[model samples]
Target: MSLDVTSPPVLSDVEELVPSRYAVRIGEIDVLVISDGVLPLPTKMLGHNVDQRARAAWLNDMFLPPDAFDWALNTVVVRNGRQTILIDTGLGMDPALNLPRAGQLVKRLKAAGIDLGSVTDVVLTHMHMDHVGGLIVDGVKEQLRPDLKIHVAVAEVKFWESPDFSRVDMPPGFPDALRAAAKHFRKEYESQLQLFDEEYEVVPGVIVTRTGGHTPGHSVVRVASGKDRLMFAGDAVFAVGFEHPEWHNGFEHDPEEAVRVRVRLLRELAETGALLAATHMPFPSVGHVAIEGDVFRWVPVFWDY
Candidate 1:
């Protein structure tokens, strides 16, 4: 169902604790990376290598100073002309997940000068809890933006909504809340969601491209205007080094396929020189991909705004 942008969704009693920040603007497109909050992930969950000495040395080399690994939950907001689009909503309130700063998306949206009612579309890169948690409020009957149209990948929708997922054993150390949330997303809200295959455009210049592996039907968004372009590469690549062109995350559903797609995307971005926006890469998670010998490097661009 399509939603009216002028009077979209209403977020009642929701408070915004953190202020919004703009990443950078490329031409007419103003991109803002809003924070939902932060998450503490076990360092070992990032990859498979478990050797203590090797892990410590790698951490020291990478300058990831002590303590538990903290991940910033960043959602990308793109504005072009009259259209305002949000890619991947942040983690909403769920006590089970132990996310203290959850349900902060609407506040950040407002801080970015984007009325929840003005959001034209919400393109979900996948059905993971972190990506779709903000789509609906916990106790509210309707969505945050009841009038907004939600675009989702066909494969992702099928997998998450399918009955088979219930039978699959939860991976060791996977949070129970996240697993439950994924199941709820599949059963409760699958009808209101719009599914797209391969490539589809939400408006004129905002396009969705299929980039599977992380999730069965995962995808990425490419926003363009004139000569400038930015690729909102959801979880296609995680952390800075995951963009190594050959590296794949251990959290991926299919590591081999994930690596293959990562390599292909790196080459494509390198050849085209498009701006890269990763959900898990540092704050404002936007940058440019550069080829360094056999591997690729992330060159972050700070927004002057």
Candidate 2:
């Protein structure tokens, strides 16, 4: 029989042709990077402070479109044999926001053999809708254990009570949508909220530390075991952030302070040579940070098939 080279390869469920989850061992701990799907956003959102020409140049250099780009939505699962920890939930289907592609976290997690009930701890980077929206999806709360602990910075909950959006430069309806989503999440999960002051250890090797700046309660998770270290850097670092740590992302509530946080985190990563992953980096976002002159570089890890 002749081979059909042009035909697409057969998949188990036919749900997706491309891979949606990647697994790696961080020494004794097991780490998984799951795709929540992509969000198409304007290039200007990357850095509104920089001139359009500069943004255009960078996008071109990367062989991307000039007008917009798809921001990768990655959520991570960490298992230390004792607890199943979820770091940041991805965006759920929000009809009001018209983002249909996002909110794939629930289904994708199931495909990866993880059940909502099995997730004992949730370490939130902040109270942003994309980071917590998946937990508030219809019927999601009912499936989760009643005692599920959601770890978030104490300042995150208070900020949404009377959020100040004066400094952010989001799209026309984003500020309103963000405020409502955060409010709804808090109301739905109030009983499960595990508020932390600055730093908290989730498990034997996984610890979360507040970085502030992106949001007052923005945080990052560090996992270390047997000389292996990886940072789940939430929104503190982005695709462009590695090269232009000074540029202000439009979503940042305090852009100037966000810049400082990015610089500090990047510097630390370069010095430590730890693996780096962020919410909006490309799928399987694990990588290492390197310093090049005055700027930093992202060296993505090679995928092992």
Candidate 3:
């Protein structure tokens, strides 16, 4: 019942017409944001608590289709000293969802010149299918180093035992799919998991902290090097979150707490002027959070071409 691990043939990242990767340097640390591709979902998934008209209007203002749109699936690779850490693996080969555009992380990593065995650590924000699916993809586990460590919050591992779905508002079969992915991912990678209670310092400047919102164990990774800082906020903040922090995303397991977590992270990013990157934002999803009175704004960094 887990994700269909049967992966399709690999496609070279060069064959794709559009760019699939972007690199950023955080002081002394090297960061790479790769596009796992995009997932198409209904606009209603953006905010199930509000009226459909409001959601539609917001999408229309952004020049997006009202009915459905593609949400970017972004994953990060961080390298500091001798350690190379992968933030989150994108959606990987979920045939049932018919999501062809996503699950491209494996091949893209190759194109980025990153060998799987070089990944010393993987810090997962949560166990959502889209985040951990790539680890279970066909031929992926065999390529990774046997000593690879996957750092996940202890709360995250416990929550999946009997995950609560009553609070989520996902599409027809998504809940089941998510549950299966989490279960299988845990079973397959149990021995390699380095469970942390609240916070873990993967390396000197890279830290993973549990924020617990979108899911009971949801966490965020903060990278600090010299005077530069970047936050891999996971699902704590979304693109629509800047203008409508109060609106509830359908995937939130605890919408009320999710709003609190989202606002808090946004405030920290805005006040400290740290760069922010999230999973479901635009391709690179690299930007800054700006505050005007009570409203928050997303200011994307100029592409470092």
Candidate 2 lDDT score at position 268? 94
Candidate order by lDDT, decreasing, is 3, 2, 1
Candidate 2 wrongly placed segments (more than 4 Å):
1-14
Write down the worst ten-residue block by lDDT for model 1.
Answer: 162-171
Top candidate on lDDT is 3
lDDT of 3: 0.93
Candidate 1 clashes between residue pairs 3 or more apart in a chain or in different chains: 3-147, 9-145, 156-217
Ranking by TM-score: 2, 3, 1
Q: Tell me the tens digit of each residue's lDDT in model 1 across 180-273.
A: 6677765656566778888889877789988887777889999888898888888777664543434445456766677787777777787799
> Which digits, one per residue and each the tens of the lDDT, describe model 3 over residues 1-305?
78776886565645577788889899999999999999898888899999999998999899998898798999999998798999999888878889999999988999899999999999999999999999999899999999999999999999999999998888888998999999989988999999999999999999999999899889999999999999999999888999999999889999999999999999999999999999999979999999999999999999989
The deviation in Å at residue 73 for candidate 2 is: 0.5
lDDT by residue for model 2 (80-191), tens? 8879999999988689878888999998988888999999999999988899989889989998988899999998888889998888778878888788889999889898
Off by over 4 Å in 3: 1-13
Model 3's C-alpha root-mean-square deviation from the true structure amounts to 6.8
Provide the TM-score for each candidate, comma-separated: 0.84, 0.96, 0.95
Two-way lDDT contest, 1 vs 3, winner: 3
> Least lDDT summed over 10 consecutive residues: which range in candidate 2?
7-16
